[model samples]
Target: MTMELCYNPAAGERGLGDLYLPEHPEHAPVALTIHGGGWSAQDKSSFCGVSQFIASLGWAVFNINYRLTTIAPWPACGDDCLMAAKFLLDGEVPEFAGLDRCKLLICGGSAGGHLALMTGLRLPPNRVAGIISISGIDELTSDFALHSFRYEPFFGGEPTEEKQTEANPLQYLRPDSPPVLLTHWDNDQVVPVESARRFRDRGRALGCRVDYYEYSTEDEGHGIWIPDSKPHRLYPHLETELTRFIESVRPENPPCPTK
Candidate 1:
């Protein structure tokens, strides 16, 4: 689709953008991809494999990025997401023209995983068909929050237990939100598996479809659950599982007639 960078006057930052569309496309569904770095680091370029893999599957994909804590924090990432979603849904780029008025699948891992859930929650209901969160956080203000005290200064003062609930992804849940796929390793040193568990519990409470899995071994490390050298089956297993979960969702959400 589109790969460009422009200075965002509103945010006063240069954001990286990448979009991949199906060949011979007039219109096609899309998935928004986010990368994780504890909100302090990471970029969209690192997602080339995931984006290309998705494009090969006949769906459009976007590897979106935003300013980091070193650049801008909290709402900066959120703002970047809002802008990207608006841009794609309006078909501002030719490659994404088909995704206008269409549904999307949002996904990410680790810090990226947190971003995926938060970004989707900030959008309209079912605006995202599904979410793939890999070892993500449920609450931004928790003691076990990935960033520890790092994000607190950004959030302003100490994050209390009461606020923890509100800061949590579960607090944002509604019955109408889309389905989700949650994955994690039994032992992730960076992001704890409990984070995924908490988020899944919230989604289930809301009656959303949640497909969660845990790798029995730790060969894949924190952000990568499927090792490339081990076997060909890992990638296919993920691709197949996610595709099946997302394909079942229908885009019945009321579309903006004029957009």
Candidate 2:
């Protein structure tokens, strides 16, 4: 495996990411991995382990860092995600030369998830195979999304119907939207699981393929939805489910000649 830091000059220094490429990259897919930190707290390093794990599965992973709310506001973070996708889709990044652009997937948890959804929703039809959201906020008007102190600044003052609907991924669902997989912890103290369910229902109603996975920690004493948490017994299962969803949505490619 090889890793390299790439910066998007247009986005400034904060718009940087670590690209991980597999040794044998022929016909490999790529995934844009975002980190969760309420849109202002974490950087690309937060998803290093997750990116590495995905890279190990024959994927070229771009773990990105976007300008936090402290630097900008609403649309800034999501715009950065779209910019990063454009950077890869431009075919100028050498480390991702072997990636199958048509098979790209966007994934993240929490704030990253919201960004992923925004990016995927705005992307050209069929550009991305799928999107994965873990504990993501689908409805910006939800109680948690409204009361969470971490969101006030990101949304730029008090939440309004217009702004809330604009950021709500559920409002963007379309029949042509890329397939999406959402995983949320049933016992989550943060974002409610109902958001995921409602989003999934809305997507399905729109004739889109939507997969929803909910996990509980009653037996384990705590929610184990996020990967890399202590007692990672559920990590493998979560990853497997994500991998399967991604592969299922990907378009099969013809055999590539040996290097």
Clashes of each: 4, 0
Worst 10 residues of 1 by lDDT: 225-234
Q: lDDT tens string, model 2, 1-259?
A: 6565555676676788888886667777778988887888888777777777777777778889998999888888888898888776655656766577665688887788888899888887667778998778766656455456766798778766777788888888889999899988886676777778888888998999889888866532225445446322236667888878876875567522211
User: Which candidate has the top score in lDDT?
Assistant: 2
lDDT (CA) per prediction:
0.65, 0.76
Q: Which pairs of residues have clashing backbones in candidate 2? A: none
Q: Pick the candidate with the highest TM-score.
A: 2
- For every candidate in turn, the CA RMSD to the true structure comes to 3.8, 3.5
Error of 1 at 133 (Å): 1.1
| Candidate 1 C-alpha lDDT tens digits along 58-81 | 667777777776766566776776
Please give the range of 10 consecutive residues that has the lowest summed lDDT in model 2. Answer: 219-228
